[model samples]
Target: MRNRLNRRVAAAASAGIGMTLLLAACGADAIESGGDASGGSDGGVDTSAGIDCAPYEEFGEIDGTTVSLYTSILAPEDQPYIDAFAPFTECTGVTVNYEGSAEFEAQLLVRVQGGNPPDIALFPQPGLLQTIVRDTGSVVPAPDAVEAAVDEFYGPDWKQYGTVDDEFYAAPNSANVKSFVWYSPSAFEEAGYEVPETWDDMLALSDQIVADNPGGEVKPWCAGIGSGDATGWTATDWMEDVMLRTAGADVYDQWVNHEIPFNDPAVATALETVGGILKNEDYVNGGIGGVQSIASTTFQDGGLPVLDGSCFMHRQASFYAANWPEGTEVAEDGDVFAFYLPPIEESAGEPILGAGEFVGAFADRPEVQAFQLYMTSSDFINLRAQGGQFIPPHSELDTANLTNPIDTLSAELLTSEDTTFRFDASDLMPGAVGAGSFWTEMTAWIAEDKADAEVLDAIEASWPQ
Candidate 1:
């Protein structure tokens, strides 16, 4: 509790609004965003966000209402969400009291256990949502209008994530792509190297880079798993990506669900595959240091080496673009760009590894329900998409609303029929393991050179009975 940074902030003030026609077009099924307008007795709500306020009328009057929000997403990544809600607040007169903390997972539970939970929480993953649902008895199920929006816009698999024992409790708020290998396009062009389409090709490129720079400062890969208390999560992402490729989706599910042991032979194979790059002294810590440096370097700084030509590739999510220094170009012909991480064989399979936040409520008040439901709507999502570094998960999201090219690509790939998508495995497992031993053991695997089997055995042993 003492370590938690319980900083409170108001949503970004109302910004220039242009999609005034969106709510007016949600058709008959549009769920009303509850809350009263700041309108006077005779006058209706004023449009500070400059959009039509009619859509919110259905949620009923919520005059001068307030909703409290808590989450792990803090500034600078948090400013966009704050700014995006401007229009919603302007129309609904709901004051969203937001508090973002670094220790959200630990503190959220503390708050709940102490019977002072926030009105809503944007869970980084459903595993925590499951914990709250199964153990805390504090999570409020999604309202009818919220359920209708999800069913109308999302596939069953997404809703299943928030559902526990057949009861739905949340909706996806944002998404990210984890299967990207960011690189310097100009560097690749200068070296006459094309983006690899298969795992073998990527390895060949790695070998080529090593052969070209023998004893030189350049390396084929640079990575870091350090993220404060979340250290080693990046390594877990590496493991999950490898798991999706080597073991395929079915076995991957079984492993995450504990139908198969964490140390199952197949999972060990996946770990070895991850080791091929991450654990390989020849391939990692380019701008950082020795392979062990990966455990100490920050994940946000892990891939920055690409910009300085010290490393050739950094496998991370699309959201990593936000980490680049301001004014850095992120485009095909610009300073940096990302390629889809290749699979073992293009024809064999190329399942996407990804993650998203689930918006769950602790209070069932109409004002809270209104805000949660609005978050799932295309209007809010589309408006939010323009804020950059955000991928709209609404199935009907307008690509035009996405301001960045990478964001557009992520959104397109998310719904593309040609590819398969799966959420992060660590975020899906039980918290005791997924959020615990799995992280600590991975750090040891890199920092101490612990044998893969030993690390796997430790994690498997930690699984709850």
Candidate 2:
């Protein structure tokens, strides 16, 4: 279940043939910025109108030419954009050289370092935007119009992930809710279990499920930690959720922003709590060591049948619904239900895991701004929803238009909850710690008899001071 294919290819495939046409229209120069609008040594565009659509009178056309884009949208997901973008290309002669997600960062970094960066880069990870702001001078400030468009589509807080030091580097793109617990209605009903509304109730329910299963045939939960290059990230989600619930939002923010050490007592407690579930003889399938060995890809799928309706719950991001076995009851009926990971205690308040694409401006051209507006607009959400994609970042997406059950569930979670949503902690961490050290340490904590403090210490030590 590791994503073997390059994500860029998937992104391009999602964008479809419009990508081909866009790529074809590119001029001889790979980094063409069109005309002499560079405005010399000033290094900033005229943001008087901000990014207003009115100033876009000549938005579609750019001095008898079109702008080209290099992006990393996957195939299936990119299809809608491709379809939507065709009109943009036709309306404006601007072309886009859409690239696959594979090695896009490396490719773009090389280009930028070589003095030939793309006019725009659609980065899927938010941390990369911070890197661009700090390391590469390639990214420019957001035009007034782009910021207005972002506020219009996604709310003010939505821009937090893309903004740094009071300047915007990226715009919000598609989003997926991670603080969800998927359960089987039939299994829960057969067991006479009620959906737990509070954290205590949730644990009490898990305990009840375990007590009911005297024999070892049934497990109460399914927890998988496999994600290929990012295997340990799943564990980081659990830790973050628990931290948010047990320690509260202020502490959670500090941890995420690196103001508090990762090895702080609160973080350690979260790790221990998750480890307890893995270590408990009655909680997880295949036990601690077995869970570690279980491929992350198959972990979510394993919860489908639940060993004679014994297993009741699986916690994962919204993307997990797509991995359900095809033609299976869950898959056939779109059988999936999600509930917020209720706060650890009533006093903790509601907390959610929010992760998504962070779009940013590379150049200040009318076509560039227009394309960005189009990509993040409500129209784009509608198009993607029609194709059964997960939740769109724009909160205004009409639930009636969402055909898929998963999309419906995601939509409901967005509007119903009165919680603070935080992006995945690991995703926000530096690459070395996020993808490398964290995974190995978490797996060790589960598989071996490692001390919680030691694990936390190791993670804290790894953070880039």
lDDT of 1 by residue, 7-97 (tens): 1000001112122111100000011112222222211112234555665687888968898888766544655666666677887888877
lDDT of 1 at 182: 92
Candidate 2 Cα errors over 4 Å, as ranges: 1-121, 212-215, 286-289, 295-310, 328-334, 361-369, 393-396, 429-436, 447-450
| Candidate-wise lDDT, in order | 0.75, 0.59
Best of the candidates, TM-score? 1
Model 2 / residue 239 / CA error / Å: 0.9
lDDT of 2 by residue, 1-465 (tens): 012112221232123211000000000111212222222212111112222233455464474555555554443344444544444444444565554443454466667788877777776556656766778777888777778877776766668777877887677766567777777655676678876677777889888887887776666777766543444556767787788788888887888778888887788878877776665667776232245443343344445644246467777766555455554343212244545566676567666666776667678777787767666766555555555544566655655545555555444444433546566676567655665577678766765656788888887888776
Candidate 2 has an lDDT of 0.59
Top candidate (lDDT): 1
